[model samples]
Target: MPEQGMVIRGGAVVTAHEIKEADIWISDGKIVRIAKDTLPKATGTTVFEEVDASGMYLLPGFIAMPTPSLYKRKEGQTYIEVMREWVRSGCTSFVDVLQLEPWMSRPQLEYQQTRHFNSPLDYAWHLGMEAAQLEGRTVARYRELGFSSFHVTIRSPEEISSIQWETLWQLSASKQTIVHLHIQNDASVKQEQRDLIRQLWLDATKYWKVRTVIADSSAAFASREFDPFLHIFRLPAETTDRAVRYMYQRFYDSCPVASPLQEVRIDCRRRWCPPEMLLCLLVRLASTNIAKAIGLYPQKGSLTPGADADIVFLKKENWLTKYDLSTILNFSETHLPTSVMSNGKWMYRNAQFHLSIGMGRRIFDTKPNVYVI
Candidate 1:
């Protein structure tokens, strides 16, 4: 990781904006300025290292949802899945979101000793505290073991114990805490349950309230067309009574396995939304009269001034239309980057991953989607 690195002559200067031909100056892994015109005094003769990003979409590196098994992902096994593959997908940071019982695995111990040693990208972890285990002695032990935050996931029917909620609230109030709850499947419950959860939502804010992230209730929330194969979580409020009647009327029009409505209930997908789509949605919602601040929406998601300098340089014109803003509109689903940086440090480039060195054991030569143990 260089102390100062600048990207010279990039297309659309910063990937988040829609434009062409721009240059950005970065210092200490942070982008300080962008110019569509020319540099100012002492700029061209500066001693900082620079890279040419001509003809590419210089976007922000991706941040993935958390997972449980990462603490033990590569420990005691012939590894198959490498973190590098995910980095090649233009992702720079991944959060480990699991209800770990304040316990340490061999991998966690290994990672603790070697995380900053270096290899691919930058990363962090979010401590998860599930409702089912909130009251247990094991959870208390783990909570005391110095975790960063607590998440009360509502993936199932939530409990109504004020005792547990108070404990979590206390933890969050200490400023060492962040909170996130699963709302995607909340719509599947009865109306009373929905009202109860929303009522309890006020308690979630009683904490210090640092970072909170939420996701789509289902695939239909984002899909342009209601493809049953790409959705899940049916809510009474989502469809109107008229649509219900119409749906029943069409029930006899389809076969069993091929039915469209049946298909919408199984689309359990994640991280498929393009970075631009996510950004545009955030910008749109955050700038509205009502300003729908969705979860811990970031102020900026790229190597822009006054924000984190996690940047991704991608070429969309190969499959997408080159030299046109069409790449901006239609490239959301496909335009992953060839290079990615986190904190101004190169994490991915040319199909190679740069994971933190000594972080894990690399026993498998090929990539496997599953990490056994």
Candidate 2:
């Protein structure tokens, strides 16, 4: 007997490129077909539940920026509560950055894996380490264990100078690991010194040909010496300055190269950018860009056939309303997902949740398509 499936009919499906009305056919946790005029008949035991989406817009579920833990039960919150909020807000997955101290054992990794078994949203992990760990095959061993992304925090220019750039870059490039260079410093660190460190790191990464993501860095957009091997992740704080925001917009507009310059923050309440622009930015950056950065492209962040059926449905009336600073302030409240689906199953619908604790799975062994976006 064929398995049960679903047909989400008459919704305007939105992608990174365009929005079109289509019926999404889902089976076995994947989107098997998407068509406008007709759908195939369900025969044998392949029963398909038809969902009326006549006045809704379907979006690929949002993938959040890298965070410490998206699955673990937080203080004063149960796993169900955390997941419910995430699904209601249209977020289906995120990259969890596992900060590791030196000399941690593989048992630690095993424990982290256990923590995600109950997660409702799919996720991946980025190994966060200090500069000292970059010299050896520390990254390679983790890659062997199914990790393809690693982030190194450089707090000072001295830290950048101390890193074994050659060894780190060679290993990363050879193993196809996405290296995130996060250059953050304390208030005591002078702006000049901070800028110098950013320059130094950029120079080194460009020279070494390592695929790198410069997280929370706006200066990368201002600099004209753009490298194809480098990606920029612009956070809300970094984009608050109008001048920096203008530079980012210009870079995004003019840069013909596909460098995957992406934004990690989407502030729905902000009036700095026009509402329409902000909405478009949210869809592109939050969903599509994060997926590409984490190497989970069409599979996780898209509605194309063969992609996972993790989807969020929004009411057309709410999404198409007039936008202004006052009305948009409650944007999130207004745009709460009407229904949410993960892996071809409806987890949230009609203001109710149908959750299973161990529904989510870990995404690993990814090869990032940095240049795709």
Candidate 3:
């Protein structure tokens, strides 16, 4: 009854505890069936339409919360390229971490529209708090355009007191939408600043649901601002290979912050987080099962029958499947995700979906294998 092809038999099926072997069948853009130790043969199945995913890690797609970072280079990535990576890297959904700046209103809508076509991944956005939306029609316009959440940056330059902070909390709580803030970086502010931040957090919860998410932690590491329990030793810049091995225990396959930070994100900005650190964040997220606490539904973080089959199958940079995503996000090194799926479409298959990647393949697909590579 569905439109897409089926995927059968992956060796490593992601379970609650570990990866196990199983047969998975997808239809209607979702996982229609999954079982172990057996296969159901059928007639009239489309030829070459099913993938025998043996030995492959059939992973649930990743969900990325945005970090006020935008790609600065215009020609660097086209819409298709961005989406391709989202899927190829096994990311089915992403939230744009935005700074509520001047263009936050108009561009955000344009961005959502453009990105929807660019990637097969589901995209959500969090608005960075600035008073600017109050003066303009930005809020009314963008809110109607589907900007459902607002992330207020608490680290303000002004002298913010506890009572005033409580007022800000009340204001956001009354809005009744998702309210989250950035709290991770402390090197830039004094202890008094940290205390004010804490006060605001407490009061914010009094009125709002108290949602929080940090986009990355490497910046916090540089600032020595990671929470004590969740802190990781800074790898030496000089010896990455040696350092990576040593830091293994300090890291999980995924490294989430202490449970407290799950309720509140400390760092709100997405500046200078290279690929390696991104991988660290994902590993932490996967390890702690933090998404379960914050997610909207059950069976998330999965690609199982009856789960929201938002799946992403990516081309691993190190060609290491069935392993954690540490290799890509740890060294700040850039690698292509190469494929992406949202609910279940091939957003990016062989390579990047951006214009650059698409144009090259279109012009060169006719070439022989010898010259193509």
User: TM-scores of all models?
Assistant: 0.56, 0.86, 0.56
Error of 3 at 253 (Å): 16
TM-score of 2: 0.86
lDDT of each: 0.42, 0.69, 0.41
lDDT string, candidate 1, 1-373, tens digits: 3243565565554332233467777666566777775554244434456677777766655543323335445452322244554556555544444444547674674455343234244444445655575553443455455444345555433563433555554554443343444543545676666545543543344332323333323322333422222112222223322222332334333211111111112111333334433332222221110011111113223445754466667774652443223312222234456776766667666767554554422211111111110
Report clashes for each candidate as comma-separated counts.
Answer: 12, 0, 28
Best by TM-score: 2
Q: Is candidate 1 or candidate 2 better by TM-score?
A: 2
Q: Which one wins by lDDT: 2 or 3?
A: 2
List pairs with backbone clashes in candidate 2: none
- Model 2, 261: alpha-carbon shift in Å? 16
Instruction: Assess the local accuracy of residue 127 in candidate 1 as a C-alpha lDDT between 0 and 100.
Output: 53
- lDDT tens per residue, model 3, 208-255: 333334333333223233332222222223333333332244443322
Task: Order the candidates by lDDT, highest first.
Answer: 2, 1, 3
Shift of residue 309 alpha carbon in model 1, Å: 3.3
